[model samples]
Target: MPERSSGRRPAALVIGGGMTGMLAAAVLSDHADVTVVESDVLPRLPAPRKGLPQARHAHLLWSGGVRALENLLPGITDRLVTRGARRVPIMSGMVSKAPSGQWFRRFDDARHLNLVCSRDLLDSTIRTEVLRLPRVTLRERTELIALEGDADRVTGVRVRGSVGDGVLSAALVIDATGRASRAPVWLTDLGLPPVEERVVDAGVGYASRFYRAPASTGEDFPIVNVQADPRRPPGRGGIILPVEEGRWLVTLSGTRGGRPSRDNGEFVPFARSLAHPVIGDLLAGAEPISDVVTTHSTANKRRYFEKSPRWPAGFAVLGDAVAGYNPVYGHGLTAAAQSVLALKRVLAGHALDSPETARHIQRRAARPVGQAWDLAVGQDVLYPGATDETPGRLERVAAGFIDRAVDAGARNPHALRVLLDVMSMERPPARLLAPDMLFRVFLGRKEPLLDGPPLTEAERKAAGL
Candidate 1:
């Protein structure tokens, strides 16, 4: 272990070393000397760590998130691109099928863009940039066991490390641990009321594999997606995303009974069975690069930490700790990035040691969390047996509106722009409900609906399909 400096500045403790945790540490560094602790030793290279199994699956960072990352760690996107990540322009570089069963046109003009890469690469890149700050120190192979303060204010963290058990006192404590976060229990242990919580479990599952890009496709291929229709039973979907190293990461997913299997032989066949066969067609000639990996932890869960009437002053929760979105929406990274931006906003005006500061920060952090939660469950709840919670009139209305927007987006670039703005998180969810967007939806698709995947001759020739 490297010797860390103990400065005279105020100190903060951030639990977790994943992207969100690192982002929290980066932001907290502006106000205090930050100490980041994790149970697993973070990898030095762009490789998977035990704590993040989802790294093996396809991950996309939307423009909304990319912008937030730029604000958090300047030049991060450039660093990632330089390290082999692809900056894919929104609809222009994508071939997609909406839940309405219409294939989207590959519009050349796009209003937003996203970064696609292995989750490992994305985390490692940000990790490198964040750890370089003199005010932030990394303590790998350490676990946060509990909070160190009372119900009124959190003063630090108690942890178990390489040598023995210990305590790290700080002016503020942050929990960035993902879906497995124990903050709720930790709060309960502090004599605070349990945070209100809900889980809209779609019973979503993922099965992902990697392949060498087909020789004919060369180096560039549009991202191919087949979205599941919640309106139909057995919601199933798949996406073929181009990552670094001439690789395409194909992830197949389904709700409940429709789930994909981890058996390697079953992978492509499942892809073949989606709403459309584009993912299957693209994978037909591709060379396999890795075995199938599956995860069943893709539920939309939220801990209403902000709603707690008694939030401790020295504490706040961020990232997957507050809300975990289904990965198919690809909003996890984006939401996490924005949550940190939210944290940065709160920290800018508040003192680190103030309990009021922590409470204010928690509420602001929950804003993005709530946005992402609504976005995910809106569709997820429509899946058969996804949740016991009944969808009310508002849910039906929102779903219907989104359905029309999807219909419009398939052909109308204007409608697509509005949808993309919301999808990118560059704009609020209401962007989809704006008068202009509603007019576009009412106007309907500009071009005739596509009968099949709109693959260009060059793309077909390259794909050898």
Candidate 2:
């Protein structure tokens, strides 16, 4: 192990420089001088980098995530919009066909909103804001080698950077290295027990490409989505996200035998093969601007660190390090942001050197992680071969009720708001079971379901449909 100095400021060591890691650094900056160590030097502008392959795909920031960002860095929403990100109102700013085979009516509601932009743009925007903090220092090309302390506490970390191997001592250490985090292995080396983990994989794969937006599309162009039914085998789906710079980021996905292809020629065809052809039809008049990028590691995996009885102090995990959700649900960023917020809350009252401080942060962080994990895996586990263990009776009952809720929400704006409240992570999933929501779901009046994609005449003309 590399030798570490004993005397240092009350600093925090963040192990990644991605969005979540940056957010963690931003929060920790107020407590202590923070060091963000990254294996890959992040880009200074809104462009893709080697570390984040998913940056090429469509990423949505739900209202929950939007609020988290604003709370962490005030006026960030405006900064992103000034740089071309769109603050799209939920339901109204979307054209979606639910897995239940009903087209969601574009209800005139603004309570729920989503931030739409390329992942690169989102990352760069957040990174820029976080790095502006005087107390936060970013160490490029630095990689974590191991945790420095034992099972009782973590004093710092052994790391290898551009210069050589050494130790960065801190009062706290946060692992935010995404899905590839080595914390589990490092923990065991410290004589701590293995963390409980579960994985629900639907074998879903994705292929995404960018398109020059059709000339006539307005700035508020709706996001077009056709969702896959988990009850059906070889599920297929597609989405068209109107991102910054007048570009459309289109992503097509499928489970197991139906996965999309990386071939650029097959991108549009795959979109056409989804449950509905609206995504394909809209793309017909648009010109491709980038080749398709594909990924196969879409799985909902959770590490229950909070449940570990032997959890150590002075070390904590956040972001995908704690739980990596299926990107299809678009909850990863939101969950991570909320986890950082929880960390902020925990640190507000507790001293960094206090016993069980890391444990408290870890437990609070798990709250958002559990919410996101359930949402991402609820439908995934229903797919055959998604998991070894069968979903319990409660899960089955919940699924049935969710299907009914989706059906009702398609026809009733009130029910739709209730569903969006949960889906957007603005409220707990229990919100769906509230008395009023139950009445709306089971007995309230519902409008006639639209027979096709609810594209406005103006939207159709703009897409040349």
Residue pairs clashing, model 2: none
Q: Compose the digit string of candidate 2's lDDT tens values, residues 308-417.
A: 98977889999999999889999999999999999998888787766678999999999989999989899999988999988889999999999999999999999999
Per-model C-alpha lDDT, please?
A: 0.88, 0.91
Q: In model 1, how many backbone clashes occur?
A: 3
Angstrom error of the Cα, residue 105, model 2: value is: 0.4
For model 2, give the 10-residue run with minimal summed lDDT. Answer: 1-10
| C-alpha lDDT (0 to 100) for residue 171 of candidate 1 | 88
Clashing pairs in 1: 216-462, 217-462, 313-355
Compute each candidate's TM-score over C-alphas: 0.97, 0.98
Model 2 TM-score, 2 decimals: 0.98
Candidate 1 per-residue C-alpha lDDT over 272-323 given as tens digits, one digit per residue, 9 for 90 to 100: 9998877888888899999999999998999998899898878889899999
Off by over 4 Å in 2: 1-9
Cα RMSDs, all models: 3.5, 3.3
